[model samples]
Target: MLNDLGGQGAISRAADFIVIGAGTVGLPISVLLARKTGATVICLETGGLRQEEDTHPLNEVVQQGMFYKGASHGRFRCLGGTSMRWGGALIPFQNSDLCNAHWPISLDELTPFIDDVERLFSLEPGPYSDVSFPFELGGTHVNRLAKWPEFRKRNVAALLDADVAAAANLQVWLNAHVVKIKTQTEGVRLEAVSPNGDRLAISGRKLIVAAGAIETTRLALLIDRQNNGAVSALTSALGHNFTDHISAEVAEIVASETALLNKIVGFRFGAAGSMRNIRFELAPQAEARRHLPPGFCHIGFEVEKPGGFDVLREIFRNVQRRKSPPPRVIFDLIANTPWLARAMWWRLVNKRLLFPAHSRLIVHAVVEQLPSPNNRITLSDTCCDRFGLPLAEINWRLSKEDKENVIETSELFRRTWRTSKFASLGVWKSIEPQQIWANIDNAEGIFHPTGSTRMGACPADGVVDKNLNLFGVANVQLLATSVLPTGGGANPTMMLLLLGMRCVNQHAAGSTPPKA
Candidate 1:
């Protein structure tokens, strides 16, 4: 049942399991445990049951030591968590993803949870597991467009309108911000501020901090400070090695006929009820030859001038940045043009406006960021949010290896395009040799924050064990992209959900309550 935290003494005095943050990651764990294990689960959400006017303010964070401050805006502070803002894109981790050897747990460990993840997302499995796609590049092709179902309509609808009246063991407390977590010999005690501004303490036998990457790191830092070197494993790794998918539009691919493009990339509807846009990456063997990290590049098929859409995007961005209404000319253009008006309305209803189909391929590259100790999140020295807790300061930095990967990968794509029969030399224009990599201005982080509280077999390498349990804290666990040791080239939604399912299964299999 959902309980409003604004009322006096609304929180339950105790719970068997406490899950902080009722977003995509935390919600599944809470629901599954309550249903499968029949355990009393308490889910504490900093946001409300639905969207609110004040949602943006709750996400206020201090971004320091970074050129880009977009990370805070990437996170949504509502009941659905970031999933509220997610596009519902999902992709499985490729076998080559294991090449980095940064992932403490083998891919096999996560494989068992894939079926559960597919079921939860209403997907058909097996397509992603195919050893190779039908894209014909003579084993030299680096990319293919695969599809996955978008989850906003399917998953969010269930969570928002869920009738949990029959779930006696589950309680979801909304508008309750967990400020501090204290680990004790028996369990964990969470200090929270209710909507009514009252201090409340909630205790649980097992604590799981499923807050997103930034918040997860912040809480770890806070807990580390409280323990005073008792859990030094987290204290050392909690705020270090933060990373995201560094993306850029590096080049374009032109084909004489649309069907000819099929030979280069796979475009088929899978049994999963969604189209797969399997992306391109540096081949594993080629990657080893080039000494490059794993990364994926997405190519958008455009039927119209891509520049026109970009211009409109920049205009809207400027208007939003200025926080002012659009000029009268903007309204006049849309008002006079029926198609423009329809596009604007569609964009309002859906975050993604439907772009007119085109045969021209626009290549956008997203490279895996090499882990850097210096690129991290730390407790801000001066800034604090509305809560007394110190704000999180990000020090995101790119590496020399990252630049080399982009340049080399672009060259590989060009070489493949030149050799391929479908891509006519007349239709395709070669990227200037000097500008092998895309302009730095076009490169942006895909906002897949990961590796801050990474998992590893040893404490020296990471903050959590393969099971996602904190090295120093016995009863506390984590479920977020923050625990990912290596950020792959694909979007992280599916893999993260798989990780959550694994945690839930492990906890349920034990089915033992902490001794009182």
Candidate 2:
């Protein structure tokens, strides 16, 4: 049940629970929370139902190479979050990502939630699972990527849009931009503004801020600012330790005969482009490790380049101008041989780009960034909202290990490509080591942007504990990308959805929702 906050006399009502940001992570979270014990869950968003914002600002941000100051990852002011046009590229975190002891819990802990998430999103399953565990144990690798014959098609009705809110104990406030959260003696209070000029002050028995990493940190800082001090405890760490996927694309032609080789290097292979085969693989040595430092769970793959350099450059320039870059990440497989892999460079780049029989299939990689305090999001006094909440000034950054992973992963695939049947396909060469760890200057934060207000078992190192409650705040839980202490180099929406489910069950289980 959702009501337009713009309607008169709507700001005085109260809800048992309040969730800000009704997009990707927040939508499912609201649903799960509401269903648990029939709690009244109220969600506040900045956009309305009549309006759709699937691909807002479809301008020329890529080609123009301009700055996307206020732009975000398909950031919707409307409801339904970015799922409306998310490309829905759902992939689960690798075992390495979900197994890190650095995390307060393990993938096993998130197992039940994963099933709920799959059920909620009505996600068509796919593959991936740890060898140590049985496929029936939890969200297995095979089940995750199980061929979803109807992959992109919707299979459930729970997935709603800006027009229709889900049916249940959940109440959505359309076009209500939540600005601040104040912890009152009785409960949590929220200050949300409507598009037409309405300041709704409502109280909730509990509060969750699943407003994406960037926004999550901003909200926390807003609370600290309103309290008359720097955003502290709950940890000044609220805005520190951020990580995002580091990605880059390179293109070239598949020298002849390579097509046959790719066929031999099958399995784990699929075609996204016409006749253009995309080969994705982990380092032959990329097995799960109990320890490899944090942020080590990452994936890399390449695609063949499709269009003219000028055409692509122009398109990218336009995308940059509009602050919306199309997925420039591409991949190609050629790691089978060492000598052949090195020779790949000579066959291509001789004043001509390399390409496969098909169009430009780019070889792309998703690398993880180690958590560092330097890559932080801080409040900007210069940019304040009408109600005095400080706007988020994200100093986007990355680490060196971030880049090495990409190179290593690519090289690993290169060696496999060389030894594989297609070792002599077209000319393939070494990845020129684009942007490596710490030098992160890719497309801002593409598919995955995580860790602003991370979750951990201990209060000293993180903002929210495993239960996802803010470390020093009482009854305040978070539901944003920041909840992920490390984003395991996979698309985050699926995992975020799973976490929301976990929170719902725990909150309803009489666990006394962790103290602030």
Candidate 3:
């Protein structure tokens, strides 16, 4: 792949619109903007065109990249962004999640966005089957159970195989790390640097901070700190609220010898065998509910769907940072079980006196956590990246709301599994006396963080308005997954993509370089 500069000019030319990131939201949004108005779109990417095919020592334990058994690297640092690692399965936020009161905007507002993402990605119907998957479980697990060769085709993208940094109208800077975003009342000026001493600055009619959640808010905060006392336009909201989906999976289930369970799961939502198949559900216990009260959040389990990863294995090889050990003993682990697991869930994966199967399944769940001051992102005096930008210091904290979500969701999972009719397949079998589960204390993240530089009623309460334009920063809009006012219970990709497209359409109408 040729490492080409996105635009012809080394530094002289400015663009109508500039988008940062280029992964999830960045990828689709840029495509949309360029397609709609033919704007001089310039996208900046820190990662080079080709991913390092070799593995370093990154682990999944702390949001680092991973290669599942030498497949494509888990996180693509290139043009596709993380979407390259996307499983392509699309699902919307739950109905209960639609009216998130804490959110400045509701799910109804995002409904159109969801539809747009589905259509744009060519999302297959299997993942969104109207009829419940043929399994006894509810409609939630459709992405897991049923699978064959077809499922891999859902949610198509054009990011791969293209000279990621080259485009007809899209000027992409491959190694450009946009470190300083100079916001002026006239327009926004961008300063991007490459490791080899390439420095470029150009103004835009509009700016979309398409960097991922962490990176986007990090830059915004730096802009704030840089102009802290210059009567700058940035409000106190640049990097205030930062939160990600906290998923807790405990290895607890013991299947019966006659369980007849596929090592993982086989899902076929409908005729589109490959389109949708993987599935699972959460059944919380009663005590779990008493511990955490619930109202408007989403809680559930994401069990592994049937089918081994042969098709995507090679795709992930280049981006994976770790070569994960082959998983043994397929057992069932509950999502949102971190608190209970830490308190009473099992973790010492090697104990044998009371162990059951060699293979195990994970129950991944995402519950709601309210935005709090403690969980804010801040700028650091040190820790700069390869670019001259300061690395962000994330002070992630678990609130009472997070704790409540876990407890209530865990209790609900216990109930659904043991009592529901769908639990017939050895799901509720009590283990032997010796093999007791242990409880966990805190739930960690799933990289689905959002709400930092949040959208709010005004500058006093939020960073950007509903349009995602920064409160006081003129001509600069943030487009990554960071603008969500209320964190949705579902994966952030679909909604983020929707918002990005919407913003792009708005910019294209009267697009130019941003006001300084």
**Candidate No. with top TM-score:** 1
**Models, CA RMSD each:** 5.9, 9.9, 9.9
lDDT tens digits, residue span 1-516, model 1 = 877677755444688899988887888788888887778898888877655342366566665554544465677666667665555567766666764655777778788887887677666666553355343544545553434543333344254346355677888877789887889879999878876785668888999999898888888788777766556744477778888887665676665654435433433444533445656666656644346666766566655643334445445433322223357546555543654665555445532343433335666657778888988888888888787778888887676678777766666666666666546522555556455444543444677888999988778888988888887876888888989887876787777888888888887888965335
In angstroms, how far off is 246's CA in candidate 2? 0.3
Q: What is the C-alpha lDDT of each candidate?
A: 0.68, 0.55, 0.52
Clashes of 3: 86
Candidate numbers, best lDDT first, in rank order: 1, 2, 3
Candidate 1: clashing residue pairs, number = 14
How far out, in Å, is residue 415 in model 2? 1.7
Worst 10 residues of 3 by lDDT: 58-67
Of candidates 3 and 2, the better by lDDT: 2
Please give the ranking of all candidate structures by TM-score, highest first, separated by commas: 1, 2, 3
**Local lDDT at 267 for model 3:** 29
